[model samples]
Target: MSQAPGLGIPGILHTLREYLVFYSGLGLLAGVSLLWSVLALPLRLVLPRRWRKQTGRWVITMGFRMYLRALSIMGACHFDLKALDTLRGESPMIIAPNHPSLLDALMVISRSPNLACIMKSELVDNVFFGAGARLAGYIRNDSLRSMICLAVEDLRRGSHLLLFPEGTRSNRLPIGTVRGSIALIAKEARVPIQTVFIETESAFLTKGWPFFRKPSMPIHYRIRLGQRFDPPTDVRGFTVELERYFQSALAEARLPPLSSMGARAP
Candidate 1:
């Protein structure tokens, strides 16, 4: 393949466009997150827990939806998330999506209101996300007992729980070891488990992609609803089954060319 400079006008213009979108997208995300955090700080202090959960999560969903729209409008990427809309207003359940990228949770959370997410311990205190997440009543993974209780309580209160089964991004192909938390939560809450597959054609934010590097555009992302498993009686067995299901389902899924992907995962 010819380098951008060698290809002249068209290639140069494409390169320039990619760079522009790349920086703009990252900037928009950081700016919005910071602004939301600042706005949420006061609300968290004033609003009751119930009001905060309702208003905060709804606000987050709309914000993420708009950010995604901006990315689409900017020609940075493409999204096929219509399938998730089908689950709206359905009974409370655990949404389990494959952890391919950091963006996976945002994709799910953006489509629904009042979805309680399990945030990374560090992110719960991150300047960009801490206040917003706390306002939304999102659970943190630092304490297992506390996390499970909070997650179960969220489910019992008619909120969808957004917890990645892989616990983190997949460093291996298909998936990482499926954690038993999903099963434990489902069984304890007596709710169903709705699986989702996030397929992408570029490794822009995968397990080991550089923050400053940009992927070739236009990247395509599609989220498809997978098997809906009822609450299992056996947690260990269910975890084994869930892992197998992901491995089998994603064995032929269209992931990016990860071998040549750049730098470390966030």
Candidate 2:
């Protein structure tokens, strides 16, 4: 009798509602993402090229904030952005973060506000993000040479760049091998290099993880600001050093959940 629902049908209904909230929030996120691209079309036409990108980024930032808030409200997940305040107003720097989950970009972009990233080429034509991303002028990672040149140009123009040194989501625990492109970009742009360590308890949205199966409710995410380095003339050496730095950080970054850690909100 103790294992049965407290109030029979009402208790069962309550349990079902709790289980469905995450799916509902997921649906809302998808709908809003699609709507944003459609609504941004007019803005693209009216604003100048640079202004379009700036305005588009702000719009997307606001949308992402709202999206995160909505999920929080629905008891889906929460974000703990540590040391993110140190990056405020800092520009023309290369932001290198470990790719632990897909939510990493959204979390970082929301906090950085004006930062741009080298996005996948497929996203350039994605129905939900195609037009908006193009208007934002995000670099596509199709051609390495062209992408690096464009990234350096973006930095010179006072725009901060968010680069994932691991290139893609890590398949195993201590992070995967980093690409040399980040070093080349830092070398050519002559900008400061900052590493961000993303720590997560859940494995959802990782390399082969499916979206339908939700991780235990209220999935947690925390990011800590790692070391900052001055640009080095030696690109290859810098890449190797940075890779080792990340390997160590991820290995030792075994932190408790945000609630227990008493982390502050972003």
Model 1 scores what on Cα lDDT? 0.89
lDDT of 1 by residue, 98-210 (tens): 98777888889899996999988999999999999999999999999999999999999999999899898887777878999899999999999999999997787887688
Q: What clash count does candidate 2 reach?
A: 0
List, residue by residue over 1-266, the lDDT tens digit for candidate 2.
01224788888785676569868977887898789889877878888886987887887777887888777787678778757767978768988988877888888887776877899999877989888887888899999999999999989999899999978877555667788999899889999899998887766677666667566656777888889999878888988899889888777775333322222333
Candidate 2 TM-score to native: 0.88
List where candidate 1 sits over 4 angstroms from the true fold: 1-6, 259-266
Clashes of each: 0, 0
Q: How accurate is candidate 2 locally (lDDT)?
A: 0.80
Give the CA lDDT, 0 to 100, for residue 184 in model 2. 92
TM-score, cand. 1:
0.94
**C-alpha lDDT values of all predictions:** 0.89, 0.80
| Residue 85 in candidate 1, Cα distance off native in Å | 0.5
